[model samples]
Target: MATNNLINDMIITKRALPLFRDTNGFIKNIDRSYDSYFGKSGAKIGASVNVRLPNDPVVGDGPVVSPQSIAERSVPLTVAYRKHVSLGFDTQERTLNVDDFSGRYIEPSVNNLTGSVADIAMTLALGAANMVRNVDGNGNTIAPTSETWLQAKAKLTKQHAPTADRFAVLDPDTDASTVSGLMGLFNPSAQIGQQTKTGAMEAPLLGVREWINDQTCLVTTTGSYDSAATATGSVTTLSNAGNAIPGQISSTAYPQNSVIATSALNGGINAGDVITIAGVNQVNRVTKRSYGTPMQFVVTQAVASGATSIVVSPALVGPAADGSQNQYQTVDALPVADAKITLVGKQGETIRRNLLFNKKAMTLVTVDLMEVNKGVVDCGMANLDGISMRTLTYYNGTDDTLGTRLDVLFGIGVLRPEWLCIVPDIVDAG
Candidate 1:
């Protein structure tokens, strides 16, 4: 029972759970999340921010005698919800296999949790899709070079983004492909090499601190956005979109994927599936729907599948018009009708992403779900930078099923939407 005590004791889990640090892929080294904890004590579990900060006043010469008072600005703090994704497992004491349990149960659950966090953080960088002005005017591919670094740093500087603690999180595949050529440094040996364990490059270079974050930085194909021929050019509401469900490709044209309203998957695209059309030279993997823009795919709001048409991530980039010529074809495989499509792959590839940010852009916060301190970090009940793993044996009254759960609670908040820049579709050689 001594070992049992170790697993059951909350204190032991709090202190000793750290021994499993090396096992975690992304959570351990997320600098921004740890650094951006807004010190709000006893805040609610769900994320909601108050934005009463006043707009910058016009600068002028000081009054000779009396000073003019600007009108009192009273504004409401906009509150946004934090997405919570958890993974856990159950074990029966009598037949519990501790040796392999870690491999089967704990690792999978923890890995999912870590991966979810990575995905969440990545959405921040996805902001590039909608930037008022981006590094590339078209928001498409760019060959890597030191000038690329200068441009990225310049964007932040233009935004008046703080010069300190700034970072450029690179898409490993894109960076490896483009950065080297731009810097004129050829190290073929390191082409597409394995990303760092923390998913970041080791050194800071150029004018700003930089990181190669393969785990969280997303590289997705384009999705079909507008279909003028359809009754509705685009699906605006989530419900009409069928809660963003999986949509099958209706047909595929050579060198290009489906043409919206023409031959798109009638219906069968999963929300999280990373799919691509087989025949097209420029492959597209749909991520999510564009909330406002008809043709641009940006928003991540879940819309279940419906019969009309499917929406995708990185907003599938297609011809200007339905009958337009397919200009994206390559010598390799061209998309064919009903070609096989794979969901988002784990490896880095065509899509590109770079998140340059400071504290104002986004804030990450972790709270103890089980304890009732609300959102306060009081006792060691919930460790901030570390994870809290606990075991609970329970049964549901309905089916008498017994299970155990070990989960985590965390959130990445895009507080100041304008403060960050998500540069995607760059060509780099990391």
Candidate 2:
């Protein structure tokens, strides 16, 4: 029969089997695998190493050393376990326990194993492209129409009324060209009447001319004048040289130069002929003025007693040459107006980020697992054992029966086999 002391020792030793080199060695192997798999630059993917034991204890009232005393005094060696495991830069570090393999780790690893590096790289590239396509500098998604120029003139005209002069002609000759260019920037098919349909109908009629000088003069359609008092009935007698017969006529009525009079005083004047007394100015000069200010219109309908004599409250007339022409013509006391472009929000940037993150995460996880699987198989275990040892095998029993058994043994510590199986060649089903 087995001694009670031996049975107790056996139990203790059996319990301590998990704490042996096998358990700690497995962790160390995992750490090395993780580092080699994820740590391209020699940084370990496993958590920081933490020793689970305190310093050596001091002995008091100790006797001479004996085999039993030594055995009793011997301390079990502590295990240095990795406390945290880093998945990647974007994710939070996960904590690990003794004999604890996370399903989360397995999923990431399987994803890495089955995934393609080239495909992953392509996905990341596409994602980055998507993100760049959607955003502006202010963290706002750029709208399709955000690049358009605001129609300032149209806005002002709509708020106010259509007037001959709303915008101050910066350069009257080039103003149309400037507006056309601005419109073309927003729309390639932009035209004067097409894009800006809100402006005044008579706006194009406004023109600029140089001001000669301020002077009053008469304008007559008739070429020459004649006197009614002349007796010779000759055209030459009525034609006056300078200072010939200044203001001798009693009435303003005069005669045309050549009149075929049937009876002199009672005869009618010929059509297209005019009469003017001597010493009256016979020339009229046209006046031109500067129209430098902006003007808005107010429409008002007028009522009249007769059909032809209606008095419109806001009468429409030919624009006068000067501001002093009429009180209604001058647009001096008017309020200033302005316009702006409104931008709407879009989801271009968000879509881009999501696409990029998903593609990259999938790729990285796949590559990591593939490398890990390769390493595990290289360590020389059973073919089915290699599949069972995979992290994903625990969560998903997709592998064969042998794989399931190996997975169970590793997870539950039921079979503490020391042998590690090498991985066989993996054939792509695709």
Candidate 3:
């Protein structure tokens, strides 16, 4: 029997691209450059690609040229998420033209699939260590304002994030509230026009083009931990004291995403909780100067009750005594014995995460899923602008209907956590 040429998989994938791109606010803006390394065949889900980050530069005097070993670290981009949407077509529906069929089915399925992909990337915004707290310096809950964007931009700038291609993804409520707050009669005519026309901050506000995404993630509760806890005073490193040794900086220094033991953490820490340690101020990424503010961290692993250690991101590497490892250091000093630990939010409260970030800060890599045996089964596969989606059709003998499944395989990773800042909006607790 001749297969129905109208139900081609490649055709469906092509029809799906416009909806997919327009629907995902965060995914479309992220770094998809890693997709260039993969091809049409044999791309396994767990396979990884090493993403290279630029090394920090050093200053030199005029006398003689000094040689420095290249210091580089890579974040592995793995294709681990495989998400799909399935639908069935009866004899009557299959007879419709491709455009008609797409309007009925493809639009809704791609919209849903885009939300799932965006949700995965939205979680990275909550895990950001640098944040514009929901409260002001005086400690009152507040919606974001123009100053908030400036503060977030300042954080990104101090981290050496690229000044170009900045974007902001706001939760639905934040989008409305921020627009109301910034569109006062005294504001710029152009900004007011943008807000009045779009009903949201769609234009570049403080040099960041803002987008409203309903799929933004929320923090309904934080990790339960004692507010007055202290570090267990044990630094996990090889030879030096949480500092880098002369020749073995990467091996000797405390690494990011490593576990640190804490004392009086009777309630333990949650994976998304943000915390800070006393006297551990964040240093400027380029100049390595202390910002005089406590360095914040996002817990990456959950700790059970009575557990002693918590895993944190953006590792606690202090400046070495010799000053040679300043390029790799993140903190001004290691937590001293009994250093106070500070938790950001109360447990069981709700807050929506609104992300403000540079394009280079986050990445989304999609690989082409293996196509089905064309001679055996009808299938279609296509790649558009680095996003790969495939469709497969099979007959249900009992129901006398054909079913189609659309699938996308991809992964999400944070290239520079410091470049991403969260401007949280308070949500009333239930």
Highest TM-score model number: 3
Ranking by lDDT: 3, 1, 2
The sequence of per-residue lDDT tens digits that candidate 1 reaches over residues 206-262 is 555545455566655433332121222321222111111111111110011222222
Model 3 per-residue lDDT tens digits across residues 44-93: 77776666667866666698988877667667666767889998776666
Which candidate has the top score in lDDT?
3
lDDT of each: 0.39, 0.19, 0.72
- Candidate 2 per-residue lDDT over residues 202-241, each given as its tens digit: 1221221110110110111211112222222111112111
Q: For all candidates, what are the clash counts? A: 45, 17, 1
The C-alpha local distance difference test score for the whole of candidate 3 amounts to 0.72
Winner on TM-score (1 vs 2): 1
Better of 2 and 3 by TM-score: 3
User: Model 2 Cα displacement at 312 (Å)?
Assistant: 66
